[model samples]
Target: MKSRSLQPQLANLPNYKVRESHKAKHVNLKISPHHGLEVVVPKGFDHRRIPEILQKKQKWIDKIARQFEAQQEFLTPTAADQGVTEIVLQAIAETWRVEYVPTSNPHVVVTEKPGQQLQVRGAITHTDLCHKALCKWLAHKARTHLVPWLRTVSHEVQLPFEQASVRGQKTRWASCSQNKMISLNYKLLFLPPEVVCYVFVHELCHTIHMNHSAAFWQLVGEKDPNYEQLDAELHNIWRYVPVWVEH
Candidate 1:
């Protein structure tokens, strides 16, 4: 990787401490808004080499630190801004309340109600259960609305994918394995239909191109020219949905 010099303002900042042992190979550095600096080194890496590496990359490290600080500023939510909890509550109350129905079985059903409120009903009694039910209901809706669009994109891109399935996934919105199976996140139901279609089409494209290389992105663009903007919007929507934790 190319390395650059640290900014002048960061020259006097304290250097992050590094530890080396027999279990390290190469050093890895990470900067995050939540965690200021983190360094990881594999076993057996030469401790003497670290100084040279750090010296060569000092500018880059400072740049990354500045970026992390900027990110911290961006993530500090204001009081007027309804936090994620409130967003989830509103999403549930607005879209989940009217459609929710608790049944003896463990399934959640989402149907159009006479009014505007969304409903959520399930057999379980805990908040986690309620969240899972909402996930299921949302996944069902996303699948229903996105499948036809997925098929169209698949055909346009000449991709070979058998079918699409929707479920609650913690780490990703969608994934496509070599077997041509497409798995979508159920929470996509909360997004606009176009954004849902973007996720569906994104997974379907992966069937033909397994990696996120230039070719893969080109294929995605062929299917949806506005894929990047849609992707950003989808990520923004996901931030409102709380992380699912199993009870």
Candidate 2:
């Protein structure tokens, strides 16, 4: 990680911190509460071009910064305070408003209620149990959406895998095993549809080339023309995941 002072050329741009991430495939801009503005660059990215890049993206950076400022001031209660109020599965384009009801049952249960809502009943007072129940529901949703999506991509790309499973991996988004089994992260539900497709294609390509060699990249490009940008977006998309899922 490197933090650069505002240079004369960057005087017009907002001061930002730069971080190198192994997952990043291209330069990406991120705005967070703790860090006002961040420029995530690849390992060998040229630092000298950062000023020019920031200048090019000045308007977008400013817009996101303003939104962050507004969020910080008017931040609403989250799972930490009460319970998860909403869950968004962007990969499937679904938004579920959550409702909590205290019940006499010993364990928490999350069930789909009518009108795009989820009802969490039984032991709602136990925040940990409620979160765990929600996480289980999220995995179920991932299987319902992601498994079929991966199968579709595999059919289209002509890359076949033996089996696919969902997991909550801390550092990996998805992986393809040696025996042609694939594991996808449930957190992928938070990413955009296109990015999720890229992950699927990435793992499917691994069935052909296990390593990220030139041949692997060529295959990925054939499947996803916009993979470079989508891959870079992954490094910044973890912010979209709800805190309850991580907890």
Instruction: Give the number of the best model, judged by lDDT.
Output: 2
User: What's the TM for model 2?
Assistant: 0.70
Worst 10 residues of 2 by lDDT: 72-81
Per-prediction TM-score to the true structure, in the order listed: 0.52, 0.70
Q: CA lDDT of each candidate?
A: 0.57, 0.82
Backbone clashes, each candidate: 23, 0
Per-residue CA lDDT of candidate 1, range 44-126, in tens? 55555655666677787766656545545344544212211222333223443343355786655444456445555565344
- Cα deviation of 169 in candidate 2 (Å)? 1.1
**Top-TM-score candidate index:** 2
TM-score, cand. 1: 0.52
lDDT for 85 in candidate 2 is 87
lDDT of 1 at 195: 73
